[model samples]
Target chain A: MTEGLSEAGLIAVVCEACGAPRTPIGPGDDAALVIAPPRGRQVVTTDALVEGVPLVEGVHFLRAHPPEALGWKALAVNLSDVAAMGARPSAFVLSAAVPEGLPAAWWGAFARGLAACARAAGAALVGGDTVRSPGPLVLNITAWGWTEGDAVLRRDGGRAGDALMVRGNIGRSTLGLLNWLKLAESGWGVDGAVRDDALAAHLRPAPPLDAGPWALAHGASAGMDLSDGLATDLPRLAAACGLVLEVELAALPVDPVCAGLTPDERAAGGEDYGLAVLVPAEHVGAFIARGFASLGAARQPVGGERPGVLWRRHGAPTELAASAFAHFSGG
Target chain B: MTEGLSEAGLIAVVCEACGAPRTPIGPGDDAALVIAPPRGRQVVTTDALVEGVPLVEGVHFLRAHPPEALGWKALAVNLSDVAAMGARPSAFVLSAAVPEGLPAAWWGAFARGLAACARAAGAALVGGDTVRSPGPLVLNITAWGWTEGDAVLRRDGGRAGDALMVRGNIGRSTLGLLNWLKLAESGWGVDGAVRDDALAAHLRPAPPLDAGPWALAHGASAGMDLSDGLATDLPRLAAACGLVLEVELAALPVDPVCAGLTPDERAAGGEDYGLAVLVPAEHVGAFIARGFASLGAARQPVGGERPGVLWRRHGAPTELAASAFAHFSGG
Candidate 1:
């Protein structure tokens, strides 16, 4: 669909699909002009999605899934990072390297999806660049947000005795991915409401956008978005804070579709885009009341124990395989 | 070279190569935090490069050129846009997709080049994401800069009587690209100092970083960096300002190596990364004293002359091919 379209034409398609720019300056100039955030600090993050690389696990993202869904996922993933910083998204820029075979309609649909996400996050698609690639389709989004004063959240703020909590449904995206891979159990059924729910989770993750700022305002100690699942991400938080995060498998707020899955499967499967947070013991009650489920607590590493996640089951220390998906690890 | 390295290890390699980030929070966090511009507005832009698509021409950026050169070119091109806006670059975020076959050493060298540019631009490499791709290498850089109040150079600010001027050498990158392709005429020689100069222009474009801000301060009406050559870009400025730009081919500040090329070749060959600026008539003397070369003047359209560039030579109107390499236009 993009056979004879000039680069400018493609850019126009994107700008039109994205509607008007919310900033003082928008696309079509040497650069976009935007109002600087008040409080003199801004949050920035970048993320990318590539064809043939599983958006979890499948070939369908490019070949079957709606191009709009792919677009939503690309922008949403970056938004999750901004949300983790407890910032309000202001604007975003995208660089898409697309193959010649991709229809112009597909590109427009993709832009619409991206625009939808930007609107939902209160961000404007301020600028971007489009180039033709002989390789697989690639989408990279860089998002910027702003926070008030020093109120932004940080991952290293947790301390021993802080309650570790999880918000949003854990393992939901993984369950959706498993369903796409046709690995669901018999009782789970191939086509059902649960499968649909799981599919939605995988395709368009709605990261809890308000949670980070809400938690920060209410005195949460530390937080990070859970993109890599508990087995992998919890330890990162623990290491950052120099404490051991001890969590019980039974307390995990697993997605309803993943009810029959094992604790390990639910804990290790990733791409949930949920918030794994730590709150002072004094604020745990307020945290839970705001919809965060307490997983366990941060503890001081004793004796030769290292600063990392300490898996527990029914009050007993447990050993669990903790391999999470890694890009270069060839997982 | 990255055989057994985990994702975190690869990220660490980049962080180390780039050295300490010049931001409050960088690389290791959910999102980097940067100080906002004092003027309450920012300039933002993005640009991308892909393998197999000519970095002007040839496969060397991945298969032959020093990975560092590729790194420098990627970021430099983006910085060119920020420079066009008369803004001081603050920080940048990069999203890089690497193939498994790319050596870890190559990635390290690439990071060094990127870091060098970041330091030179007075900006920091605050954050990025690295993901493995089964396709050609892709790099996208999003840069941010700050301006004092609304003191930005917009292409539309040119007046009908503004003097058209250019900063830096024109057709230099294209000459360098031609040298790399071994298409330089025999009289131009294959490996002399001129060739080296041209090659450097193509590989590590040193954009006129101070010109935009200086022009704005000196009452220049409008400005933009010439990435796609004046044949394509001048008309954009003219269109934005609702006027016709009349220019003399003899007035272009062509590179020494391009002495033998046709006027059109020198005019239309893209990627010069120079500034095509319009200064008010009152400031033309000062603009020239500051090292800008005057081309001609912006004029109100006469006899239905369209709002675009009007090529002239030896005091007479002339026609030009004006094909400035549009992506997907198949050149």
Candidate 2:
């Protein structure tokens, strides 16, 4: 991290910790080589995490947050996107720009975290870049994978009459995020088990990796990750399939942390790295047989009779309003 | 550039400019898909550029430098690595963190420039990440390529008794960078067409794309781009091959403007982007006959006689001291 330290020296220090022999060509060559499936296409996505964007101090995490958490979340978000496409993640390339005088130990911790998470998620670090900047640290990750089976799930691949389903409880991450922010401001002691669960959900989102491959094999019509909240993202899925998405509020696998929130408010909460998927009625048995996790099979599709998002509460349908996490909409 | 612009809206605007159907899958969904070669390894490398490093104000260019130039150079430097590997550049992903209030028009221009350069280099912009940073703009590119033939050119593939040759003029880019920096500081009027030429050389350098493939076919044992200058880079090449690199002063393809500079100084000016290669003695005739554009065959390599850079001037050889444009060794 010193001014006199060379890039090669920094690379050496980081690579020492990041070494896992994940790929035939990893980090030191002109570029890393990833073997593409001889038959299937590669699914890829990129995401950039800027300081103070989605992670405001009172809303996301404190300034004293660990680099390990940062490293995990940076890759987790992009991996969630790949999971949305129903592709098993293969490898990724990471790039970070950090300010000078940051301790070498910080990079060591980050590299360790990144390598550990990648390995845990069945992914590998094939390539990366690091440089000093006169700016806040920024991390960007590009992840790619191939389909587990023949079909590579697309966001627009669903049809009318598809059953609406989701994996994992909705709005948990949002509840966790809010709690973390509040606690950071209050300096309050823990709220026992419930708050801790919420905090974990917010701090380290576990993208539904198994559900993606399962959807592809079990006949998922269309699917996408709930990143910018269900209300914001589900409509897009409905719009992509030219159908009106009708969500039964009672069917949502609502978490204990979101006990008091209205159904619509829970639907609007962000950071749930879960999938909102469409499955056909005929394959409904197959989908459930494959053990598709949370949010369960309580919801039914509106058969694309109309185009938009509709929430079903007590058999009454209402239009869902527009909403998303305004990461870049603030000054 | 406005504070209230949504990330989606900004992405739409940027994608509009960057879209040209360059790849089968271009910048959407989870990720951009680049078809991998069914055989052969994929060459990859990443580079991150900060605002001030290697290009200081009143040293490299004016504050109002063209966005197109910046975009071109960001990819150009990465493409240089691909070129060094004797691989045809197939795809690349770019990520940038821009400060708030950076005009959308600037993005349009930058995207246009990046697309144009990628097209010119036979590469495609497969994916990218864009976000608002509470800091200066930082650009990072990860580029990968696949080889034309069986041989994958590596920096450490050569032998002690190989011949040393170069692909193009070494000092032009260095001269160009210096002139542009001097002019940026002085605000002096143009020195005819040559100054403009130098500025262009520094701003948008065109690495010899064909030279890499030619080297691979003509039996180049070892090769790498002349990045980080000849003095610093050549020693590394020598160290990689376990031999002393001997460069005849007269054999160096230096620019006329660098006539008065010391050989070591000329060797230290970075960013030439040409290739310094080691060729076997048997393939020397085929190397020149195959039409390598810049540097011709002029000398033979000493068989690991010493272990460093050896420069010959007036029929006398001496060791070149360590010198390079160090971005990290600061005041």
Candidate 3:
């Protein structure tokens, strides 16, 4: 039998271990308080991971991995939104509608996972509400970040001459998801280290959070996370700026772990949690020189902005379709 | 047939109409940005309203009221948390797990109600995420506030003999819930104005957000919202302060709307988003001088704090029971 630590004990443990260094008031009261910025701005965003949908029955989350990984993914997805904005991840609050009668250790592992992710991102789990539900897991997390001065990023600033660039590796999670679900048999013949990593990526994503502010400093005009497939998400930046993206097939970063997959299969894959940006054609050189070096070390001319709806990649034109996870319409 | 607006269009309407006033950056890009405070602190708290649990199918929310009122109550409950901290509500992010195939009009009314409550609280609906669920509505709202310096009020700083004080009316929502549920037949023969007001109180709760900062300014030691009925919640403040509270039963404010109710039921019914405070014997005069007037003029010599587990009120000792809406543990 798992010894169940009450909710109060769980809160106290997390507070002491993942104590905030930046904020003045730390969670003990009805709410937690963060130190307000002087001339800077604060960023906020919210996202949810329902138990059944994203984490299908024995498909994505709960049944496949450790409880800690599920908690990590919960906060990591929201952090991806903060990273999409050119800012430093600061603090977050989690509202969990958990199933009734779970053991104390389960919550301990979950909070530990959240704290580990928060510690890595220089963030703190300030405060949140917990309630019991018969439903599977209805976890909603709201993340915030600090942006210095007026230097914030948006997804609609792409110009007709701007180039669409990815801040990090893509499609690991899509393949990772397939790998986790044991549904992929792509004839890549690459296994061993790469296969395990892809499986791990689906459980815990490492978004290119640092690239956001760096790109903003290096003159990034538009930016967003590549949680949705690039085939759809990149065009969103283009659509926001009233232009089409001309993407080169070979230019998109392909993780060795997800090799031999079709370009559309990977590019249109969801749950990658990577960062995508648009840089003006002239400033592209500067962005490469000063932006992210790890990604730039192996970069290509992925795409450019155009005044048409057709998105060209490789040699063929791809339609600007709805995002991979578009809710109602089955596009 | 109810026409559903596309997610993008709905986002646009919410951004334009429910625009933020306090934050420097409003919702449009990847996230909403708020201007950082110079020397103050930012407060955050989260709460949720499940469809079937808190608001039954044909009772509390969906059946008894308009969509706008439901939206108002959603944000209002979170505002009560900010009020409990003696902080001004600043900004909030809402993550709504709405059912699939809902009409566009539903989202519009919800956003309008959120904006209206935000305007009243001097806060903003900065940003949020909307997802589709086949299940009931699961709305989670996380609110932020700006508190000056280190003036945050907690619920654990009471000394023996400190007077337990309430900021406003109590038991309105509890009785109002009964009125909404058609359970209470404690006939006072009152109709028209009082009847409708009680029902309205349960639908769109107006937390005394003003009393927070006011009480903090006037030498308040401890405070929190009376959300879980005074019987259960006051003991929590007493327990947090390591003392027992002797509340005066007849002195508790009885709403004209909830007339002819038993003292136990009125004071112990939950969902009244009023503020309760603990003021030391010496500073009681100053608290009244600068604190809320409505609670001040009709105040009584409610129970003094004692160093024991026993709490007394209305002549006999009051046993602290779990709130009516205590999620689990069978009440």
| Cα-based lDDT at residue B126, candidate 2 | 74
* Model 1 alpha-carbon drift over 4 Å, by segment: A1-6, A22-24, A53-61, A183-195, A321-331, B1-6, B22-24, B53-62, B183-195, B321-331
The clash number for model 3 is 2
**What clash count does candidate 2 reach?**
7
Runs in model 2 deviating more than 4 A are A2-6, A20-24, A53-62, A148-150, A186-195, A291-306, A319-331, B1-6, B20-24, B53-63, B186-195, B254-262, B290-306, B321-331
Candidate 2: which docking quality band? medium
DockQ of each: 0.62, 0.52, 0.47
lDDT of 3 at B9: 67
Clashing pairs in 3: A249-A314, B246-B303
Off by over 4 Å in 3: A1-24, A53-66, A101-108, A159-161, A183-195, A280-286, A289-310, A313-331, B1-24, B53-66, B101-108, B159-161, B183-195, B280-283, B289-310, B313-331
Per-residue lDDT of B1-331 in model 2, one digit per residue for the tens?
4354556665665556556343226765555655656676567777777665335421222324567776777788898888788888877888777677777666666676677778888887777777766767777788878886556677777776677877665666666666765765766344322335556666777888778867987789888887767776777777666776667766665567567556656666777788888898898777767654222222334554556666776557755544534421121
TM-score of chain A of each: 0.89, 0.84, 0.81
lDDT of 3 by residue, B172-225 (tens): 776666665453334323332334776667777898898888887777788888
Error of 2 at B225 (Å): 2.2
Cα deviation in Å at residue A116, candidate 2?
1.5
State in Å the error of residue A28, model 1. Answer: 0.6
Docking quality of model 1: it rates as medium
